[model samples]
Structures are given as C-alpha cells and as structure tokens.
Target: MLDTTGANPFALSYNKLMDVALLLRKYLPHMVSFGMFARVTDITPKTVEELKNLHHLKLDSINIGIETAHDPTLERMSKGYYAFDILEQLSKLDEAGIRYNVFYLNGLGGKGNGVASAIATADVFNQLHPCIINIVSLTIFPESQLYQEVINGTYVEEPEIERLMEMRTLIDRLNIRVNLLGHHVSNTVPITGALPDDKAAILREFDKAITKFPEKELKAYRSRIWHL
Candidate 1:
C-alpha cells in the first residue's frame, strides 16, 4: 500500500476521520498507510485506541514535537503539556502499536540551561521508543512572542557554541537505537544518522564545530536565515 499523510492528521475529529476514510476509499484505495504530526496534548489513550481499531484508516505513525522534557523550559515555552503528559500520551501510542518520531529542540532552555535541558530530555527519551529524533535549534524572529520575551529581559537565547555543546551532550547520552536528524535549516550543523552506531562520530563533529567555529560566524549564519 502507498503511504498517504497530512500535516496534522490527529487534528481531525472523529467525524472528520470518518470523512477522510470514505474519501480515501473512493479516491485513493491504495493509500492505506497513514502518518502525520500531532502535539503531545492532542494525543489521548482513547484516540490512540480508536485509531488502532479503525483498520480502514491505517494511521500507523505520528510525529510529536517534544521540544524539551525539562519542566521549567516546557513551562517557559508555554507548552500546554508537561513531561509527564508526554510520557502518558506516548505510552498510549505504544500500547496501541503505533510508531512515533519526536523533535528535540536544541537551546530550548535558554542561555545557561542548555546542558541541563539536554540531560533532562535524554532522561525522558531513554524510557521511550521513537523511530527518529529530529533536532532543531531555536531561532527567535522579530514577530514571535519569544522575541518579545527577549526584549523584556525575561528570556535569554543560548549562544551557538552552547547549543552545539548541548547537542553533543544529547547524542552522547541517548541510549536508544534511533535515527537522529539535525538537517533542519535552523541547525548550525546538519547531522543525520542512526544512534549508538554513529554516536561517536556525531559527537566529534559537534566538538570540531564548537572548537573551530567563531561565535560571530555562527551568529552570522543564523541571522541570514529568516525561516526554519
């Protein structure tokens, strides 16, 4: 069967899911394997079970943006769900036999908290199973609320070097076997490979970048990009 998906499939209500099933049957019968993104708060045990039972829909995979498992950083970013909520919801997905990929946003904990955030995130991830861990660095734009927080002195952005260090720490600490993707435009270094096997090489790359790349050079690269 061909894989078919949408930007945020779980955002659909029960009736909308039924509508989609009917449309798929009528227009794209071969498109049975489904995958999409969802927020941690949007995932519920009931919804996961329902998806599992809906054999025709075949929603088998999902992507969740679990930026940082550190409670303070999660709260600071105004993520509606906490670390416990993430574990609770993802456990439901596991029970329902659904696979998921998660995002680990670098520099989420601000200036001095990068390493702490990395450690906290690694702790949470060790207990779970995700096919992929996608990494992206935080890039605050002028129109974003985070930018306002930066202006008011309530939030501080992590430096590029610190972000690289945080990324290295995360790679070093992760114990699970999964693909680590850092190809997002916001990242200073594009890294992608399977974990444990490629862990040492990934760490070495980060170490090289940290030692050789000047702060102004990295900051300049960040400034040139307008979107992530």
Candidate 2:
C-alpha cells in the first residue's frame, strides 16, 4: 500500500485484499511491514482475522481515528462508531495481535463538554490499549461540515487553552502504559512520553504550557495560523 487513501482498505472485499497483498509481495520484497489509515468503526471479527493474516504478511501500525469517545461528540463529528463500538473493535484487534496507533482530536466536544470528552476518551484508552495515542486539537476547514456547523452556531469551539486543558485532563485520566504524542500542527505545546511512568513529568510539562501560553494569545495564534 503505497498510497494515501482515505478509504479503509480492510473494508474492501477478500479478493481485493488478496490482490493488494500479492502486489506488495511482488514489488516490495524487502519491506516486511507497512501501515495504513483506517477508521475505528470499520473493524469486525472478519476484518480482524484478515488483519491478522495481513500481519503475517507484515502489515503493522495501522492508524485509527477514535477522534472522541463521547457518543454525542462522535455523532456530531460524523464518526460512524460510538464509544462501546470502538472499545469492542479495539478489543478484537488486541485479540488478533495487530498493532495500531490511535489518533484523538481535541476540542471535538466543544467548550462545555471538554472534561466529559476527556474522561470518556481516557476511559476507552484504559480498555483498548493501543500502542500509541496522538493528540491534536481541531482545525477548521472552510468546505467541511464542521466549518458549516461552526458558522451556523451549531458547534461552539472551545478556546485553544481550553482544548489544552482538556488534553491535560486526558493525560491525568490515562491509566494505561502506552506512548502519547502531541507534537502536531494543532498542539500548542509538544508533549511526548509514556503514561503511568512519566505521568508526573507530563503533568509538569502541561503546567508549563499553561503558564507559557495564556488563553487569549493561544486563541489568536491558532486562528492566525488556521489552515484547511
């Protein structure tokens, strides 16, 4: 898979998957492992078994978008799966010995729901246990449904610092042993480390971020640099 596909390759038919695997075996003889972007809702027991077979052919580190674990937020964000569905699918992935990284978008639940979003997300992470968790705040795209929602006053975005606070709450609530990565275009302060081991240190880093960047300035900075 040498393509940037928005589609879940696993959602394709068995024959299609076999064609892909055969193509890779023919062309990339030395590459033992590869990765792809997949949605959390697309996994089933059959998909997990196919993924396990793909793992035998050296497919690794699939990136899944959990985005938010709050059911309302997931629905508003247009994610096809709810928290329980995500947990169930990830559990299947674990049973299949397939490794994956999960991406969580901050500010998905907006201002009043930040803490709730964080707590729910942390709850899912505690159960699912992915290899890595990538955190980044939401950014608006003019053509997307989110931008329309924001413009029409349906989605109220939280302040950038409020999003950071939610991120802090997530860090604090994390009870697992996975790596966390927050160095992205949307992260105000880049935080990289593992949980339960560097928990205190990560909290200190978040405190420093809080002190270094005030809410007002962060709001302006993020808006100024906003892109599609």
Candidate 3:
C-alpha cells in the first residue's frame, strides 16, 4: 500500500542477502519452505529471482492486500496503487513463477459503492491471476484516517448485509481460476470456495445469505446487526 509505482529503492544488497542465506543454511539444514506478506508494488521480478536463489529459505508464496481495484476506494483507504499498476506488478510476479494470495477489503468503498468496487476489483483479478483471494469487511477503529473520515461525516459505513452483497458481487464477477476465501474476523458471513469450479455453489450460498433476512426488516436491521 505504501508504494504506488512498484519500486523499492532500499533493497538489501545481494552480498548482504548471501550472508543471511549462509546463516539460514548453517542453522536449519532441514528447512525447505518460506513465505511472506509483501507489498505488490514493491515486488519486482528481480526480488522474486533473488528469493529463488536462496536455497534454504525457499520463498514459494506471498500475501498482498490489493484492497480495491477502484482508484477512489484505494485513495480513500490510503492504499497507494491503482488497478493498472497492480496488474503490471502481479504480472511480473507470475512471470517469475511466484505464487501469491490477494486480500480484498469489503466495505472499503463505503455505502452504496460496494457493487461498483467489487466489479472493478473482479475485472482486475481476471487478469492478475492470484492463487487465492481473501476478503475482510471494514472495521473503522479509532484514530485512523478512516475513522477521522467517519468523524467528519465524509464516509458512511456500509451495513453488514451490504458488505456481504459486495463480497457476493466480487465472487460472482470473478472469471479466474483462483481460490476465493472470504473468511475474516470482521466479515459478517464466511464465503470460502474455489473459483470457476465452485462458482455456482458460492452464488447459491450468497443468495441464501441475502434471503436469510426478511426483506421487510433489512433496512432497519442495518442499525441492529453490527456496530460501525
């Protein structure tokens, strides 16, 4: 989220990396796997290649928060990249044979814009091709910029059901071969399944979730269900 341009100026030198690599090899002879949460903007092909060279710490996967593909939503959340920059960097990771997971924040777009945000995000996912896509609903804690926005009446938090609809929209719009895991502490409903293979099933599950609330009380339920 810090990097909008996908560039890292402060990378560890290859010799310094080799020093750490030697220590890992000497201490853990049997260690064969490693993973990391990385900023998609900072991961270049060279970074992937460097990780691949380290035999003891086999970097196989990375986790990144793509937030939302909609630029305004990203701007709203302080996530620094746009859809094109994200796609380009993820493409680099793919070309370097690095598998990765993406995290999407539901309700980040605020109120009624969830559907638009989900559609835009799904459009990018189709091209970016993450191994897994995870979801988390927004929770505005105190002292953050988002919280400040809420204080100033600049942002209206979406209701829980609306957030679920946003998640469903993202699930419905995806046309890629990726695992969709919508389990998070903040999520109202847990939506977990594989894409393409479980698309229809997930849709059914979403429909059930939507219909669970009686249509008559859904509007009022917003104030009753989850605290903003």
Candidate 4:
C-alpha cells in the first residue's frame, strides 16, 4: 500500500486503491503487515480520507516525508507545499485513524541557516506527534541545485560536528514522546529512544564530540552520500 510517488501529491494515479493493492490482496496473507508512502502534506484532507479504506485491508503503517518546517526552504526544494499544509494533512490522517511516520532532514539550509532549519523542523515534529521521526542529514545530489552549487564553489558544506550539535540542541528541546530514529547514513551519529529518557544522554554524546573532535575529523564524520 506504499505510495511510491515520492512527494508529488498529483502523482497519485487514482482516488482509490490501484491494481497494486488488489494484487497484494490476492496473494498476501490477511494479517500481514503493510506500509505505503504518500505525500500527505501536498494533498487535500479529502484525498487523505480516501485512504480510510486501507484499514479494511489491514494496513499497519504509512510514511510521509516532511522535509523541513520552513516554507521558503520547502519551496526552494520544490516540495510542492508549505509547513502548515503538512500539519493540516497530518491532523486529517489522525482523524481518519491511520498511523504514520514522518521524515525530517537536518542541515538542509546549509551552513548559515542550518541551525534554524533544525529548530523549525523540531517544532513541526513536536506539533505533529507522529509515531516515528526519521532524522537525516542533508546531502547534495549530482542532479540537485545543491550539488551544482558545491561543484561551482558557491555552496559551503556544514561541518558534521556542527550539524550534530544542532541536532543535539533539537533533541534536548523536544517535549513529545515519539521515538527518534537517526539510522540514516548522512547522520554522523545514529541513536534511537523515547524522548526525555535516553534523549539527554544522546545529546550529551554529540555535545562531547563537539568539544573533543577536531574540525577535519568532524567534517569527515558528517560527509556522506545517503539521503535517509
């Protein structure tokens, strides 16, 4: 039931289940776990309600990519929607009784604005209170504007240690109880736990690294090709 259309709302092929769901229904066991990808942020709440039928088929999870909380960053990334739009769509999903995970990116704004981007993203996650929060560090792809800027000497990459410090600050400030998943390769250090328990310990690890690790080593630790 994963909607593998990336983040495009209009990319949805139909209002209801397509042939894939039918095929899965035909061969898969009734109680088997299933998940789907959908850009809940870009579509109207009505479109999300259509997914209510998924419960009839026994869907276990859904994942949405809520890249950043800053509207300008989203527009620059071409995510096709604003932060509030995503919040509205997530609320609708909750009302429909569908469980979902949200993905957020750190260091997306690069050096100058990276810290603010992390803070804004944390605010959104606290508000949504999703089942899981997947945090990933920003990576420039060869085909993306970020990549071009890097090649042309216009983009200065953020050090891995600074990024980790920003993330540590974010983790320290989160008030909700959702699980934090930092398993992505872009992340310099990956740890998972319920907030306010291991949360302080996790942030402490990064804080120590910030003070102990040298600039070059930190940069090397943070550089990676994976997105999430």
Runs in model 4 lying further than 4 Å from the true structure: 1-14, 18-23, 41-45, 141-144, 222-228
**43 in model 2: Cα distance from truth in Å?**
1.5
lDDT of 2 by residue, 53-129 (tens): 87777666578888989998888767778999989988877877878899999998887888899999999889876
**What 10-residue stretch in candidate 4 is worst by lDDT?**
1-10
The best-first sequence of candidates by lDDT reads: 1, 2, 3, 4
Give candidate 1's TM-score: 0.92
- Tens digit of lDDT per residue, candidate 4, span 95-208? 667778887778776676667777777777677658888888787667787888878887677667667877886787688888889877777677788776788788777878
The order of the candidates by TM-score, greatest first, is 1, 2, 4, 3
What would you estimate as the lDDT of candidate 2? 0.81
Task: Report how far residue 149 has shifted in candidate 4, in Å.
Answer: 1.4
| TM-scores for all predictions | 0.92, 0.90, 0.80, 0.82
Q: Kindly provide the TM-score of model 2 when superposed on the true structure, using C-alpha atoms.
A: 0.90
Candidate 1 local lDDT, 127-194, one digit each (tens): 88899999999999999988999999999999999999899988899999999989999999999999
- Model 2 misplaced stretches (Cα beyond 4 Å): 1-7, 45-47
Kindly give the stretch of ten consecutive residues in candidate 2 with the minimal lDDT sum.
1-10
Q: Name the top TM-score candidate.
A: 1
> Considering TM-score, which of the candidate structures 1 and 3 is the better prediction for this target?
1
* Alpha-carbon runs more than 4 Å astray in model 3: 1-22, 44-57, 214-228
